[model samples]
Target: MSISPDSTNQRRRLPGSDAPAQAPSGRGLPRHLLGKLATTPTHPAITVGETLLLPLLAVVLGLAFAPQDPLLTQAAFPWPWLVPVVLALRYGPLAGLGGASVLLACWLGLNVGHWDVFPQLYFLGGLILVMLVGEFSSLWQARARRAETLQLYLDQRLEHLVRQHYLLRLSHDQLEQELIARPMSMRDALKELNQAGQDAHGAGPTPQQLLRVLSQFCQLECAAIHPVRDARPQAQPAAILGACDGLKADDPLVQQALRTGQLCHINQAVSAQQDTLYLVAAPLVDLAGDMYGLLVVRDMPFFALQQESLQTMQLLLCYYTDSLSMQRLAQPIVSQVADCPPRFAFELQRLAHMHRETQVPSVVVALEFRPQALKQDLPEQIMRLRRELDEVWPIEGPERQVLAVLMPLGTSGTAEGYVRRLEAWMQHRSQQSLAEAGIFTHVLPLDGAAPLRTVERLRAIAHA
Candidate 1:
């Protein structure tokens, strides 16, 4: 069922006063602060031991290998400063500062007794020189780290883009293949629609015709079309085909379809329900935006709900409804003359005569109707039942009109079977009665009955 926008309004409203509350119901900490408390920060990559170990190792090697004389300070060639430079580059200014601290401790401990004024000054100058180098190295290494990080980021981004492009291309190709396959179903629907268009007065195809197309082309097992309502199971159905027994129109799926004004799957609409019966219900809306009826389908073949086939079903139903609109807008029926019965019978005879050599089964089904008891949709339903190979004509009398259906290749049994089917269908489809129809109805088998006898049988029913 197609859900209209107003479906939201179907829900019951809660009773309440129209006044604002004095305070908000929710009382708690702000969201950002709560999120901060909920998450833990990641540990720094460089540990304290790693930062101190490199600097301390460099100082121990320099002191143990250097000359004992104060004048031999230049002999170490500032190799200890390499430790500070490396720390500055690898871990920024903090590690550089730590390296500087290690260097001062080694200088003070090794040179404590030998430090004269000039020697101490030399030591101060050396310490200052390495600290300055450490600071400069820290700045340069930070920029290098940033550049390396940026290079990795760009490489990763480019790789992702290439992968995405390939995926999109593949998807496009698949979509093209799907599109190509889609047209086959549409073509079939269009072919049937064109034939329906050629029906009398450019009236569109009938509902049964549309259902037959949908069933055959879409491979559906059961389907129905009825006026759009919160339809209950026990209510009369407008037109039904195939095997859809025990299905309810008031199901949540049906209501959802009605409310949304779009097709809804039975499985999707009621997830809590264990059993899945039908697939979808499509709204048959007229041109004026009112829902003329609903088309409910079930038990389609596996994977039959392809995009193309569903769309074709919708289009064909629209074409069928259009025929009905045209037929409705056409001129009203005029009263028939007294000779109309014989002429109607003659047409049936003419068609039946043509099939005599082939001995194809043929018969006439006459439905007699009293003027006052006729249902408004009775004429349209009768028209809908007419096959392409069949003809329908009105036979008028003093009190009523009889609709005579001519089946050119039908047998007496075929006509008789149709009568039983029609009677049963009418019992569930409407409140119209056989008594209200005011006549007995029977098949006029062109091949089986004698001309005089057939005339007598028709007259007996016509005047009953």
Candidate 2:
């Protein structure tokens, strides 16, 4: 999810305050004193140790350097007051109060025999002041801690909301692109359909991909594509395709999508099973406006089914249907290609290039045999061939086909020589297999730079 800079900034603002507070520094004595008081101990044990040690040291200092004048007793002076104030500044009111109490007790004990050493009013006044400062310091520290915690929580929530907003924006942009590039050709539709099939066969499209598209297009959730069966007497949905939140392929809403070639908006279809607010079914139609299948989406927001979203939904349905159709048609050939010796596919591609370069006749040699005939042993053989080919000639194409150097940079005679070598290689491999598999080669003569005809010829041969 992409977060807009403004939204991010807004979210990061200090909690309970619009602007961040500047750190307190020098100038005013009370502000400085307050700042000192706010510094809480990071470690509880450290605060406790300091509280224990300071009062003990104050008592020893008062005894070791006792004042002779009773009116100016050292124990009643600043030393006793300073120790507790320091404790309060460092660890807040509790530590300050505890430290002050110990210092006051020590002062009274040390001067008990000399009544003139300290005045009762002087000691009482200093103790009260120290306690007040400690309590105030603690209150300030508590407020600051609470503010910091609240700010952190607000920052996290804001980040999450921003992320979600960005994702929705990105989805909107993608939908816009699809709309602009609409009225897609049959070939493009087929290509998209093929890609979807490949994704399904491999790892399947992620929920993000499905949901983002559905939400953008305002599609119904229960739509799916099913294979036509011969003996079942009724068509069964083959795979669960795209869907919105709570709708599944088995829902009656999906059957509605299949039946109507127009947008099917059924509010409260699954309100009993789930809190379904709305459902919309759009037909997947080709450029010719021929219905191929249906797209079912459920629980979509009312605003999502606007005309623009509905149009995008129609386009998505068309694209998905075309992909499914192409996959169905290409499956047999792809299976056959997969079963063939891995090197053979590469050799065929190489042969195509050789035909173009040499302007000589070249053929795509394929071994014809049903997969069931050699199913037990073909997988191991294919795996071994794949590894060997990867080591020798690792070439990839846009179509994801394996290609080899069958007729490299060669003359007409070189082309023929390569063909004979390939034939010999096939003959040697055929001896180990007991199937109706035999090497069948189709030759095509390239005409000038135009390899289209040659390509068509090779395709025809493969089809045959």
Candidate 3:
């Protein structure tokens, strides 16, 4: 993703500085000199040049103006010490000390006998001042680098999200036209795939059905899906669509996909490829890096091989892998809590996977109502109270009715707003507080903890 230079410069601007924060560009003398003075030097060669240049320039200027006193000892402001101070501010203590050592060398070689008395105080004061300024420079420069790094990361993340959003909107618009021909949106196809995965309590559809769906959505004229064994694509194809030859494990595209664990196509410039067997090679991998299979496409429409189609194919493949993985991941929760709906279990597992990968928190709020509360249709009412983004799973029991609300990308603080909204609704509808209505709330934040423990805790709450 491309970060805008204007935005980056805006972000890089430090307080009290009019010019933008920038690294040394190592260009011509003026820019290079200004950049080095303005920013900390990252290149070792620049540091060496800077350390030597500043001291030598100071000595040359001192010789030109005060030939007898090259150290500028008789000058009003002790100008010779300014070189070390500038070096210190530019590249920290080491460069500053190096500059100071040069001046010290000049004093030892040229002025040791010229001065009747040793100028210990003059050298000591300059050394102390350089060290202090160098220390100060080191701390702030370190802070500036860290800030820039953080800003760069945030900018890249923002760019990625923006691009993804744009693609999502474009796909949605295209899906409208595609629906007339295919009778399915990407969301609908994914839902069907998810349902298929949940069939027979998580056995999922076979590879043949998977390839059929991919052919339908991605317009794969001829393709084969081969099961990967021991991190390698097997020779025999698990599922084949249209005319297909045997699997070529040595295919360049296939090898590229295998090595990178990503989608690779004939158009990629990773290697010089005058000839290739397949048009596209996509690894059926999930966020957890589990390789389910390798999909190699031999033929596709000229128009259908664009970015949208390729991304859709990869997305569907990832969704398929995640669905199968979710089955295994949700098994323990389902086994423990038989009342948990398949959809709820799948979503919980997916959220846990998201949390692990991105550290994005999801919340599960269990609202338990008294047996009498059910008469008011509390579970149903609370179910209606869920946000559009929330997924509600209502569990009914003899003594208590529980409504589990899954809030994706929510935090404890945000969940409180939801609870507050629920409370307000309850007060208006039933004219009673939660305690009076005999409803208790339990919150579980999915913050990288084992999701099984959450299910176990919920099971205990349900039984209690």
Candidate 4:
């Protein structure tokens, strides 16, 4: 979905024509004109010109066919009125009236001194017809505009979903390779990032930690992270690795990434001679569309600059941005809960935000274990059964231990399924039912409440 600048500049010429096969808009002029005509013009001059041009042109053609009946009042139907009807439909009632005014002017000019012979009924009927048609046109045009706006939003949404799907698949492949070569998994790296972002002593992650994390996962050998201020990458590098050069704002890849708010690289479809100093340029933008910084890669392996590597770099940058946002969202909840894990708090706030904006439900379930169940390791068994999308925070109290599970996008049925799964697993391991094992369950749906409230409610259940 990302269009390279070079592709936009390059135009294919036709075999027999001097002009380019496609217009600069990439779509031809007819489509462009249609799009233009769909929207009402703000300039009165342009609308007036359009309204006058068509009716006058029709008058000229009518004069050639019959000079005496140029107004077409003598015809079976007032054929000349079609021009005004079309103008009204295209531009609303005002434009149609303008066109009718042109016709009226023409009629008055022809019958300058013979005003007594004016066809009152003919002009009256034409005016009434044009107005009615114009009103109908205005109504349909409004509907069409609304439909087009909705379609545009859906198209953008679909494009975003497709891009995310591609990134997810590419990241999976890159992650598998990383898992084989590196000891740290993506989750652990994100956890480290979350901790660094949540560090109260500092503002988000330090530049050095960011460079190290990128180098470890993205294989960034010579790169620099530049803080973006005033909507531009700062001149000085925030962090640099190896012999990375200073920030180049004019670099094509950097410019493209900044313009599109996406990761861009020299390997994209572009002219071979395209000028660029960096191999990759990625913006650190979160899900909320806040830009924290820009990452520029100078010296990376050619194979590593492929789609998978670029995706990994983009994914890490996004995760870093999300960590910063998550820290802010979860801070209130963490402050209230004594033993809440940073990871748990982050996911809780994230899912709560998601539910608020998207109406995608999630569940917070607290499982309390009696002292008798401590011998059975029921809490540990439940931890093992946690889904990838779920986060668990274990609360150890004086009398009992509790496992608070965060299930994202979980419905009532999903909560029941999760509890059922846990019960079955506990039975298989301990040869006893949930009640027999002295395990208690409390379910709370993440709804229209503050995240801190949700966590506080869960804490109350754990203590109860």
Model 3: number of backbone collisions: 0
Extract clashing residue pairs from model 4: none
Of candidates 3 and 1, the better by lDDT: 3
Worst 10 residues of 4 by lDDT: 13-22
- The pairs that clash in candidate 3 are none
Candidate 2 versus the native: TM-score?
0.29
Q: Is candidate 1 or candidate 2 better by TM-score?
A: 1
Model 4 misplacement above 4 A = 1-25, 29-204, 215-222, 229-231, 242-246, 267-272, 299-312, 351-361, 411-414, 424-431
TM-score of 4: 0.56
> Model 4, range 321-422, lDDT digits (tens) per residue?
756766676667667774677668876776676566556678988888999888878788778888855789888867888888888667888889988987
Q: Rank the candidates by TM-score, best first.
A: 4, 3, 1, 2
How accurate locally, in lDDT, is each candidate? 0.56, 0.46, 0.75, 0.74
Question: Could you tell me the C-alpha RMSD of candidate 1 in Å?
Answer: 34.3
lDDT by residue (279-390, candidate 3, tens digit) is 8898887545689999999998877766567767776776677567756776777877766765578668767866775566789998988877777777876787777557
Between candidates 1 and 3, name the one with more favorable TM-score: 3
State in Å the error of residue 329, model 4: 2.4
Q: In model 2, which residue pairs have backbone atoms overlapping below 3 Å? A: 193-323, 219-297, 220-296, 220-297, 221-244, 221-296, 221-297, 221-298, 346-403, 346-404
lDDT of 2 by residue, 292-393 (tens): 444445344444444445544544454454333334433433454433322333334433443444333443222222335234443234324332112122
